[model samples]
Target chain A: MEIKENKKDAVLLLELKGRLDASTSPKFQKKILSVIEGGEKNLVIDFSDLDYISSAGLRVLLLGAKKLQSVDGKIVLACLADHVKEVFDIAGFSVIFPFYDATEDAIKSFE
Target chain B: MHPSELIETNLYREKERTLFYGFIWSAVFLLPKTVAVVLSNSVVLLADLLKSISKCIASLASWLSIRRVAKGKDFSYNFGYGKLENLTSLVLAGVLIISLLVIGYEVYHRFLHPEHIHDFGVWFGLLIVAAKFVIDVYFWHHDRHLAKIDNSPIMVSHWKFYRADAIANGVVILSLIISVVFKNISGIKYVDPIGSIIIAGFLLSSAYGIVSKSLYDLLDGTLEESLQLVILRELAAFFDDYKEFHGIRSRRSGSHLFIDIFLEFDNEKKMGEIYQTIEKIRRRIEKSIPGSNVTITPTRIPFV
Candidate 1:
């Protein structure tokens, strides 16, 4: 998977591409963890090009969400594919992660 | 919202309306039919009355199941109430089988000792049959049209009931005509019993079909071969991503498919990268088979 990071003030916007599975989640997780360690609070993951996500990927997101919660930080998801949204729904992750239709909305929410 | 989702919502509302109307119509007609059976002393009419009763029960059960399923998953029921449809089907099948046996026994007894017609009100029987025919035809057409679009098992089952009732009404009318026309024939008395047997046979076969289908679902049967092929094709495309992958298991619940796969990736690869690869494969599988819940487990060694 490909992840492009854009820093907007205190928020970190990540545009992801390709698949987020067992093989790619570790890299994605490390990237997010490093950003969190750098004291970035608000996170927005843009799933406009993301085609898939499995349980392993979900776990990474959950971990990130929990980590952010500990530091009074927040993570929002945007532009999810229908199937990917369904996965979040089935796994009951929708309640844990707030979803926005666009990255701008996600960034605005962090304010 | 997508157009398809809007259409689906409309269709679901329409289905609920149709089922509610059908249940009300069946109950409204059931009382008079039961009275007719008591007054006419016709085995065919009695069988028809039993069938109507069973249909009403099945309709109510199906409606209840649909309502329960609509409530979605709860703390008590994690998988939702989709299985209620299968459970209702099983109960309906059991009722049908029992009704079939009762009708069959009545037919057999009538063959041994035929009784003289006391109050064989042909006009009364015809009136009840005609009313039933109208109701069955209306619901049958409506249910069939909806079933074609939704293809829900409960809707299909309701359609079967209506179709069988319409056919059974025709048989009852035919038996009535034969008994009335050939009043002098010694075997004319067997017409109604023979009609009951035919109706019983129809019920038995339909019940068998329902029982087998519901039982298969209850047992957690695998998805259709075509769907399994789609999953396999998706997996085949990602063969190089992992060193070895096995233990692909799948089952269907309602309209959703649940898939479990185990993969052994290169040991040197980072965990996040491994997750990304698995996610890609999951996306491919989900695209090929929509509305599937997938679980991917990473293993160090292949299971022997």
Candidate 2:
């Protein structure tokens, strides 16, 4: 799995490409938390290119969302591929996380 | 590829194919029919023209709804754009109603002051009827096949519209034949306008169908009783997992189902056990109702 990070106007955009499974979830969790630790509050994860995600990936997302909630910060998702969206739907993450169809839309929400 | 992925791919391809065909029919076939209407000044031709126009508008609305559904949920519209399909249906119904009023008015005027239709063009009318018959048959088969696979309301609606239009065209043809056969019969002049009224009536009924269904969806109507029963039966299997469960709400948005389960777990159970039980119940519900988003909330207070 590959992760791309960009900072735009204090919003940290993390774009994930490739499979997100048990093998790669820890790294994903570490990268996201590091950003949060670095004092970034508004986060948008782009999953337009992500092909697959397992329960491990979902755990990391829930942890990140929960952590952000504690600090009055927010994390939203954007451009999730159909398969990944289905997983989110099946796991009921849709109720917990806010999702946008575009990264720009997600960023706009923070404003 | 997974079966779900394969099905998604098929649906995408079919949508594109159907939209392309619609565009071809609108530009090539409908434009000529509009010209024929201008030439004939016949009530039956006007009804045929209006039917084609409604079909074109309906096709465009269906495509827009499909695109909106793909866009998914955003921060502003957290529940997703599934309702856009219903909204489109509502708007289409309104348009059909307006068209029906206009056609009804014209029919009424013609009944009071019957005018001879100049350049009736029986051959042209026959050609259009034949063409419409072919198009209707093709779309009926195509839409029905896709509807069976996808179970989309929009697809079913399209098939219904096409079937209705074909029958309307047959009525128009019969009216034209009556005018041609009984040219000397004064009563025969009413046939064309009467045919227009009949077509308007069909449109009115279809518009009513669309309006009622869309309104029901907009109001967040619950899923069909049979589907809700399936979910309830699945939840019954996990009776021992939770002390009590209530407020099991379920609604549908397009093809997606949203379920909220409120349960009072046994206080003696550990956190992990409670989580596992919730997950089990959710999975069971989802297994019974595919594409269901199940949210289980643990309530501290048990319902009386």
Candidate 3:
């Protein structure tokens, strides 16, 4: 999977492309950890272009959420494809994360 | 021992009792099934006989392993004898494979020499198998309940084990009914062998589930994906207590969950206060993940 990063003021918006599966989750994890460690608290992950996400992908989201929550910040998701949203709901991740209809909404929610 | 410890120990004892009784039950049913096979040329009964034999060995091994663990066989080991249950399950998977092979042979052999399955023993074995089915249903439900309470791998394995047996028993009963009642119908000779092949298919599926699951846990793999998320969620909820998240290590031993987390706390905090924080985190994680033993360490160094 490819992660395109763009910062909007204090919010860190990441546009995910391709698939987030077992093979790609490790890189995603490292990126999340480093960004969170860099003191960037607000995380906006846009899943519009991402086609698939397995359980491995969910684990990384959790780790990122944990770090962000510890700092009184949050990770919000946006533009999730129908199937990817179904995956989140089925995995019981919908309650743990805040989802938005657009990237602007996700970043604005942090503001 | 403490009351909670005593309760946990009793749960394990109950687990052992369930498996021991199941072993005896499987052993007792073996004879009539075998006799039924010998009394008739029905390949389905032969396949069931093989399944009964396999169930006997599997349950016996399962019981023995739990018995060993309960009897303090883990004094020499650090993590205890929990993985022994997984090892035993892997062995039982092998037994299922053997049963499948025997069924394959019987099915192949019968296809070559078509024989009518209606005889004095064909209808006779039906009663024994029907009784066995009822008993299997009981154990199947019972094992699930026990496994949920104790989270023992043997109970989980036997639950699936009995489910497969019960389902195959259902198939065998149906095949026998067709064999006896439809014996006058032309081309009825193939039904008995077809039933044998179907039993082999169930055995194959059960073996795959057992072998894959047992091998993964026996190798000290991490917690499953959902469970891993559960830990992170708990940690996230208690995020403010610790200064830094160093690392987390977790694995499954049979049905037991072992999780260790490393965190950095402020050095200025009193020892008692830091311990209270750790205890709270540990308690929450353990509560979220049932049958888990969680340890939180205060350290700057990352530990996996």
Best by lDDT: 3
Q: Which ten residues in a row have the lowest lDDT in candidate 1 chain B?
A: B239-248
Per-model CA lDDT versus the true structure = 0.78, 0.75, 0.85
Model 3: CA > 4 A from native: A7-12, A33-43, A51-76, A81-99, A107-111
Cα lDDT of model 1 by residue, A24-107, tens digit: 988997898799889988999999999998765775676576557657887899999999998777655776689999889999
Report how far residue B65 has shifted in candidate 3, in Å. 0.9
| Highest TM-score scorer | 3
What is the lDDT, from 0 to 100, of the residue B23 in candidate 1? Answer: 78
Question: Would you list the rank order by TM-score, best first?
Answer: 3, 2, 1
Candidate 1 residue-wise lDDT, B86-180, digit = tens: 78888899889878888887788888988544345666777888988988998888898887766566777888888888988888888877877
Candidate 2, residues B165-277, lDDT tens digits: the string is 77887888788777777778878778889889889888988888888877876788767655655654554455446654444566766656788777776678898999998
| Cα lDDT over the full model 3 | 0.85
Q: What C-alpha lDDT, on a 0 to 100 scale, does residue A70 get in candidate 1?
A: 59
Q: Compute the TM-score of each model's chain A versus the native chain A and list the values.
A: 0.97, 0.96, 0.98
Q: Judge the docking of candidate 1 as incorrect, acceptable, medium or high.
A: incorrect
Residue lDDT tens for model 3, B2-65: 9987987898788888888888988898888878888877889998988888888888888888
lDDT of 1: 0.78
Q: Which stretches of model 2 miss by more than 4 angstroms?
A: A1-111, B1-6, B71-76, B118-120, B271-280, B301-304
